[model samples]
Target: MKTSLPIFVRNSMYALRGGFLVRPLLISLALGLAGMILSSAEERFPVVSAWVPDALFPSHADPQVAQVMLSTIASSIMTVVSIVFAILLMTLTLASMQFSPRILVNFVRDHVTQWTLGVFLGTFLYCMAAMPAARSLPQPFAPVATVTGALALALASVMGLIYFIHHISRAVSVNHIVDRIARETERVIDELMPRKRGAVARGEDMEFEPEETEFAVLNVRSGYICFIDTTRLLKLAKAHKLRIRVLRPIGHFAPEGAPLFTVSHKSRLTAELDRDFRSAFGIGPMRTMQQDVEFGVLQIVDIALKAISPAVNDPSTAINCIDQLTSILIRWAERAPPATIFSDPPYVVRVILPWPDFKHLLDTAFEQIRHYSANDVAVSLRLLRAMDDLAATLNDDSMRKEVTLCGRRVVANCATRLDPTNLKRLEDRLASLEARSPSFATRGA
Candidate 1:
């Protein structure tokens, strides 16, 4: 739905939505205002907090007691908030050094860390906002209801701090990191591809073809294509009765003065029309998982590669990454891919866009890891099983054939590096995998 909006607005919303800004800012403001409002209301009607003396603290006449309590809670909450931030920074550093630095994006967008910072700071502000109401000259008003509310918030902050420590402990583990990335990738797949696999054969799947057009739109800005507002593009094309072909797909970089897209018919190209066309692309310096599933896959692959390298030699970690990658591939196979050729009328193609197909996504997910893990028997065996799992889930023959080829490549790569017994293990898995695909099974028969 974000792709439906204009480019700059969507990009700004995405940055605010993904970082630690929006949620915490809104929460802190809301609680601070609540504290002020509650204090004012207590002054108008004293019955609201009238029972505080008999019930909780037994200091109804003493405004000094309320002031000290509010001040101490506010200062202590600020101290604990500093500790929370220090823990978060430490976690991000450990995750980057141990696994992959690319996963820092995931940690930045983590819900637990964001919420932990929000509640602690929010509690501190609540106390500060209510502190002024507990003044000696102001009719000796203690604002008992406001002080009681602050006490409740201080208790919640203490419990939240404990839970945050527990969460950060698990967040640094390699398994949790990869699993989280795979889950996020699958969520992106669901949003980008809505239909189920068997419900509709991926229709209008075509590659980009070169053809001369009347007008070539040059990119004014330079960055990676984080998003392509396809809905806006199709609307503009249908309105003008022309064909527009995007030269670069999502996650591609377009330097200034490059041909970003071409228009089939443009007798008179106005500056307004050109600006509208360029605004459909959301460009940024860094890649994201918004419209790019491969970005997510690469994050996990980075970890797997580091795991199997000569220095770390962490096969267990590599195998865990392989299993998680297989899960992501399965989700991809079960969903219909994005429509490459956008049509307005029944059969007329108005907008031509390029999306990464199954083969491209498959290779992006596994090709590098397969090449690197050729010598490790445990990691290699896991890769073969991953291919088999993906092949079984694929509904289309072309995708299955691609999976079959990848399986053979794994065995071939391992054949040179692995000993006889280890090589035989991969071959056996490949034969079993080939039996399931009709092309491979028929060829053997």
Candidate 2:
């Protein structure tokens, strides 16, 4: 689909942020250019190298020594770059096999690893780009200033390499990966649902019924709906005096020729209008965290499932996942639902969009993990406590009731597999979950 400029730019920015290409490429190229410019300047103005220590490069008039040093540094850096890349690839392979392949996004988006790649490659480029300046045929000239910069970069690369290794060590740990996912998910929740707790979500459950008069906009693209430019969507609807209902959920796949959206009045829909509506959407081959909160939850769920699997039964890791999921649920409970009905003016709905409610998110976050961990006492206890913690943060009775019901489900599932003593522990936790401050919701509610 052809997206509008703003929408395209946003998708591009997200791609750049998540991938390994753009940032490292930019950094390496910038450093390479800096190397060329510094070398040229020092060649013309030898005074630029006056501050260079005599011990480091004894003579500025000697080109052979500078060339050899530059060549050695360049070759050494290239070798290091290959080793670093190998290490990174190994880490990615291990993480994907052990946890989830989806988390590869997090590793690629890591700033430390990216900088490490860039700096190592940049140092090599700097040396290569400056080596030509120390040419004997050019009357014995050495760009000491440029070489010094390369030396500094090489040293910096060494330190960065050390730090990158440390980062990867911690990053591969299940605790760190789970926390990073949780934090990123919380950030998305904050951005999408900014309102404080207890604020009522307006225009929620605003369903649009299909009518014979409505016109369907078939999707020409086949991919997940990575982004939806709501501003464009609302403006298009208001200007055409039509009510628009997006037929597919954001972050979902819309097959080719499938209906993407529907307009209330077919008379107002034209060829150009169809293109504009399509332009408001951005489709990609995979789901992204740009607007998909559930994607993050699923990533963690994947790890939790693997952790609790018979092949790798790690209850402590499962408990950590529950704690992070609890953090996310609490954050979600506090934020207002995203705006669903967009109106140009007051009391008039032009665009009807729906977001994942607390119930939907609650299921997405905990249901699978809860089901899988029902047998493990530590994991089961954590799940009950997580449910209790999620409910306690909210003031909405209905939402709290939903959480309590989920807790009962947890208890029931645990009962199927737990001893009497363990089941009683869950029963006690359920009692507290069902009864909280100022009279909580009852089981019948």
TM-score of each: 0.93, 0.95
Candidate 1 yields a Cα-based lDDT of 0.84
- Candidate 1 root-mean-square deviation in Å: 2.7
Reference-based lDDT, each prediction: 0.84, 0.85
| Backbone clash pairs in model 1 (N, Cα, C under 3 Å; residues 3+ apart or in different chains), count | 0
For residues 106-151, could you state the per-residue lDDT of candidate 2 as single tens digits? 9888888888888888888888889889888837787888888988
User: 145-172 in candidate 1: lDDT tens per residue?
Assistant: 8898999999988888889889888988
Residue 166 displacement (Å), model 1: 1.3
Off by over 4 Å in 1: 1-5, 198-214, 442-445
What TM-score does candidate 1 reach?
0.93
Q: In model 1, what is the error at residue 364, expressed in angstroms?
A: 0.7
Off by over 4 Å in 2: 1-3, 197-201, 205-212, 437-445
The clash count for each model shown is: 0, 0
